[model samples]
Target: MVDIRPDWQLLIDGGKKDSDGDGQRAVVNPATGEEVATVQEGTAADVDHAVEAARNAFEEWSDTSSEERARRLYAIADRIDDHFDELAEIATLENGKPKNQSGNDVFTAVETFRYYAGATDKFYGDVVENSKDELKLKVFEPYGVVGVVIPWNWPPMHTADFISVALATGNTVVLKPAPQTPMSSIRMVELMLDVLPDGAVNVVPGGVEPGVALTNHEDVDMVAFTGHDVTGEAVMKSAAENINPVMLELGGKNAAIVFDDADLEKAVSGAILNAFYNSGQSCASIERLLLHEDIFDDFLAAFLPAIEELNVGEGMDPNSQVGPIIDEAQYDKIQSAIDGAVDGGAEIAAKAESPTDEHLAGGHWVPPTVLTNVDPSMPIMNEEVFGPVLSVTSFRNDDDAVEIANDVEYGLTGGIWTSNLERAHRVAARLETGMVGVNRPSFVSLGLPFGGYKRSGIGRKRDLTETMREYVRVKSIQIDHTDARYSLDLDLAEQRTY
Candidate 1:
């Protein structure tokens, strides 16, 4: 096992390692269903301790110069680049993402650090001239200590999303990494400790207890969470008690719309890549496809054949295009989603063959599948499956496509594929999602804002400058140097002067 010490590890404190006296849990490899590592099953007490440490160090760290913070962030990025391969392998083994995707995820952390490094001073304030007598100066200041809770899909990238920018804006952190994939985050924080203060960043790896504790802690200034919608509700309630602000990134069931005049090849390629990437574990995955009635049959004919060509194998295999489900709960969830859809009259148009290798027998494997005849009201089309399952339906025109796409409770993202530039622009503006790609189904820009309307999330993420603002609070400092008389409705100034 990678982290075999039961008594030695359970919590990572600043630059020190300690045990919570709780216990240890085995980290299973999704590809082989084997124990590949072990991590501490930290308790609530550990979370409290971590938060205390962060609070203690917040003042000094936040007071440091922006240039000094930028220098330290760059050092962390350099360390990540030096050990990219090792971190990627650990992530692949635990998260069941293909090797290349794992590498990209790991590199994403490097990019995030470097991106925010240059943005340490980006959260600029403004000086407003209300009148010559009174001037207002607004400044952005960091929230003392931020509590971050991340999901298991993309640990490396999410670590950067929730932590890197928080640090850039000068907030200390207490991260509760996802239980299923905490090793990589723990490793990432280890690198941060090398360049940051002892209590500037901390990680407590465990199941639900640590997350609950971190969110509920009164000392935490802000909370950033990424996970299921149901769980997000609980976090919101917990933070309510302390009256702390929260940034919730609940997953979504997004849609991809294809028009009759669209380029079939491009639509098919985008659909496959987005639907099956990381076994559809991402919030941006297009869970449903809305095609125009005129081209429904033709699009399916091209898409079905492409879906059948997907390869499912070990995550570490260089040639493997797909990997196993993250765990048993998710495997069962996907299977149930598919079976329920079929029973409800949905037809399976295409299904890739399951892994035939005897070694992967115990792995949580789900075949890449395509479903048709699914009604808009069906749970498979409404609920976030978060699996390699895509449902198809047809729309009449641009208006019809926008209606169907906006019908769901989630407005995280959507795609509109068409050759007509007017329709692309027209329909894109009408969709309810926060971000959209005119011709690309699953396209995302690292520099643009990413979040959703409705239940998908609260607040935005990415674009270093904007995210820097999320971790800070704006303070208005107004100066009054005027001795001149001012217009007052109540005329109370004369009475006060007397």
Candidate 2:
């Protein structure tokens, strides 16, 4: 068993470590079905201390040039890269995801640092000419303390992405990883201290209470959250009590439309990968598949067989194409969603059966599942199942397909599979999502602005220059140069006023 007692302190500014009493929480290895270690839960007092540390550090850290800040961020990313193998193992053990996926997560984290490192000096404000000889300039300034609540589904990738960008933008951060998957993040923060000030990146591990404290803290200038809509609503409500600014990426029930002229081979492969990637835990995963009636039967014939061939097991297994669900609660939730969809008149195309004892020796495993004959109005089509479950429905034409895709409240992402260039652009225009993937599975990039239109999320993430602006406030300055002796309008304005 991993030692737990040594990790109960908060890393404050200047590398000062302070204990948060003996409040302990166990870290379970979802793959092994056993507790690996225990971490001290941060109390309200601990949060206050961390926030104060950031508040104190901001005075000097904010004054540091963006180049210097970018240098430190690069150092942090390099440190993470040097230990990618070991960190990938930790991610697999705690997150129950494939090792290759873990490595990909690390790559994304590193790329986020690289992307924002170059974007620091690029965040320039504007100059407006309201009148001659009067200059109006806008300057960007970082918010003092930023609170980030990362979800468990993709801990390292999500937490580190937020950490690198927030710090590079000159804002100090306080992060609380989801209780289920917090170890990798704890280690990331521990190593980050070698390059960054301890208080500049504070990590307070605990259950919902610490998250609540951080969200409601009056000193916290801004909040960034990635999680379910219900919890996001609570965070938003609490932050609203203080009228604090927030950036949130909530849940999504994304859609994928398949046209008749599409390549069946490519569509099936992309759809299966889209629906089953990360066991469908991703918010951008395409959960709804809308196929044109002309080729609906042909598409199902190709897709159903692919689902039956998926290899599901532990993350460490080289042969495993799909890994286990994150934790027990998620396992149960996935099961419930599958059963509900079947009960709602959707036919089960292929159900990944419960594995044998050998397969269940470690990890919480679930196989890829697909449903057909699903109606547009079914709960499975509307709700965010967030599992390896895809609901398929048939549409008469491109317009009907787009209508079915836009019927949901979520506007996060949608996939369109069509060979016709005109129809691809035409149908893409009708869908009401923030991001669209035409003839592709997924399209999430570190440089793209990622967010939703409606209930999916609020605000944007990871835009080239806009991300830094999210953590900053604009200060407008106006200078009156009309007093120059040679100014053409200086005395004329004064005489007109007289």
Which candidate number has the best lDDT?
Answer: 1
Q: Which pairs, if any, clash in model 2?
A: 31-363
Q: What shift in Å separates residue 31 of candidate 1 from its native position after superposition?
A: 1.0
Every candidate's lDDT: 0.86, 0.82
Off by over 4 Å in 2: 1-9, 14-19, 130-132, 357-362, 484-498
Query: Model 1 — TM-score against the truth?
Result: 0.95
Q: Kindly provide the TM-score of model 2 when superposed on the true structure, using C-alpha atoms.
A: 0.93
C-alpha-based local distance difference test score of model 1: 0.86
TM-score of each candidate? 0.95, 0.93
Minimum summed lDDT over a 10-residue window in model 2 is located at 1-10
Candidate 2 lDDT over 1-498, as tens digits, reads 223333445566646355566777777766668776667777777788888988887877788898898898888888888878777777777777788888888888777777787777788778876687798998888888999999888887987778877887788988888887777888778788878765888888778778999999999999999999899989999999989999989888999999889998999999988998888999999989888899989988888877888877767777767787888888888888778878877788886654465636666777888888788888888999888999888899877888899999888998989989898888878888878888998556778888886888888887766667788889999998787556545655556754
Best by TM-score: 1
